[model samples]
Target: MQGNFWPDHIRRLIEQIGMEHPIIQAPMAGGPSTAELVASVSNSGALGFLGVGYLTPEQIDLEIRKVKELTNRPFGVNLFVPEISEAAKPSDKVLNCLQEFSNELGIDPPQMPGPPKYSFEDQLSVIIDHKVPVFSFTFGIPDKALIRDLIERDVFVIGTATCVEEGVLLEEAGCSAIVAQGSEAGGHRGTFGSTEGTPMIGGLALVPQLVDKVEIPVIASGGIMDGRGIAASVALGASTVQMGTAFLCCEEAGVPGPWLDSLLSSKDISTVLTRAFSGKYARGIKNRFIDEMSLLEDEIPNYPLQNSLTRSLRNASKDKGDSDFMSLWAGQGAAMSRKLTAQELVDALVSETYQVLKSIGTNL
Candidate 1:
């Protein structure tokens, strides 16, 4: 066992989450994170995550049940904190523009989904009712009562932060740990309260700074693709590492073929942070839809609205086997992604980190 080899902090985090390794297969929501992938990674002794950000409460339960059926080991579920802020207000002009976009995609213009919106509160209740062992969230801080309830149930809670202050708030809100997500991270930017505060700090620079500022454990995220990255993060004071982009190419990832192909052929610096797809800043591959939407950036609605508006286009693109009009979310380190099964990837990560650490330790 590598028990004695782990640094004190990493060991503590591993014990905190009850994982055998300090690696966490990031919850790559919106389809890539499959139940099989989550189970395989957890079964490999690393924490697996189910990205429930886009799922309905019923869907969330079904996904959790599927993962439980596959593995008796501990795993986690990731959600987005619902933020009803004054970021963007709906306008008639915006609706017309969206209608035009719908016309271009040969789809019906969207109508308000109405009162019973997909409730985060509902999802949280499902997670609790099922006694989910680990829960994590991003976008904004979860309410205190929910945090307390999860703690009472012994759920190890994690929150995502794009900067030190965000991390501090999460720790203050009683998160078990904070995932310091740098600009290079894929999917949505987890910036909250102070959006400009942590616009785009790179992983190497962001992790250590947060570690210095916060008392809780910090997990490094963004552009991390291999064991070298993990070993480097530990040296930089990250207790563990959360990775998303690297796992997109794994066999069990529910990614479409065109999307997977782009990641497999991607190079460093190929991704950009854009809000054209989901109304919130997220890192993804540059594509036709992104380029076209860039011209209309100012009119983009707030996250929930914009995300709902474009859902059909992205979904249709996937069905048509086209990448040009799809949201190809990926991190900057996509070039380092390997085509392997989830278990193979986890094992490789562990072995590679062990070797890197061992070599460094010997030299020291």
Candidate 2:
């Protein structure tokens, strides 16, 4: 708890990323990851991240400046790697299915969306231009030349992987670290290697496998909420832990009131993985929307397309303070969430990790 409790390599990794603790706040892109939350966590000695995957280049620039103003400590920015091809247009059935939900919410039905306002290259240019300290991405790996560019700029690049195969691919692409995201993770599944269904590996089983395969440091993620989880991750050969659900209810997170209420009342069995909200699969608390969409699982369109279609309905639901229609993305550990300040949560996690390690007679 006091001096260098982590292994030498982990200590070096921590220092290299300018973090005092081996915790990295997961980048919850849509809304939960606020500037205040990111800064508060970084200020608490843990690395915080801004989920800028949905932001425009200009918006990303502004967000980086805001976090810098709040805290000088190092933090990270996460982007979503663009899919190789455009999503096929949805059929009438899929459109009608979404229309029913819009009618129920008394909002206008969604229309097909145009191309993304900005490209990944546009976003990456902004990140590089600002010289962000840590750059992490999900969904898939970036080009080798781009990865080289980031490393040359001294940006610590991190990539997310749901299985060992993906982790090995990331390492081969020159990632500085890899986040071994498990099936228990909340947001979009980062399973890109598979040609079939999404990978369903749990953190306990996935972390060590990825560590053994990849030479780069593996950061354990998924269902990791407390100090016990952190201790377990370290024991599994992880260099650090990336937690999202644990910080969703933090005061500084600025999550919508309805979503906050849902998390506070959730139980272990409340969450389900579905592509109801977005075409891509993600985990969130079960709701009428998800339940209804499950019946038409096969009819749903792929990501970005479905995501664009539902944007208005989601925004309307948020404005009306209705959780029933919200995405409500959360991990399996949502039941263990705590309503605390970011700093308080980080402090408690560090203290708890120290005690857990000490109690188990692990050498410091």
* Number of the predicted model whose lDDT against the real structure is largest: 2
Off by over 4 Å in 1: 86-101, 195-198, 362-364
Model 1, residue 203: distance off in Å is 1.3
RMSD of each: 1.9, 1.0
Q: Which ten residues in a row have the lowest lDDT in candidate 2?
A: 1-10
Question: Residue-wise lDDT of candidate 2 within 99-124, one digit each (tens)?
Answer: 98899889899988876677999998
lDDT of 1: 0.86
* Model 1 vs. true fold: TM: 0.95
- Best of the candidates, TM-score: 2
| Clash pairs, model 2 backbone | none
Q: Cα lDDT for residue 95, model 1?
A: 71
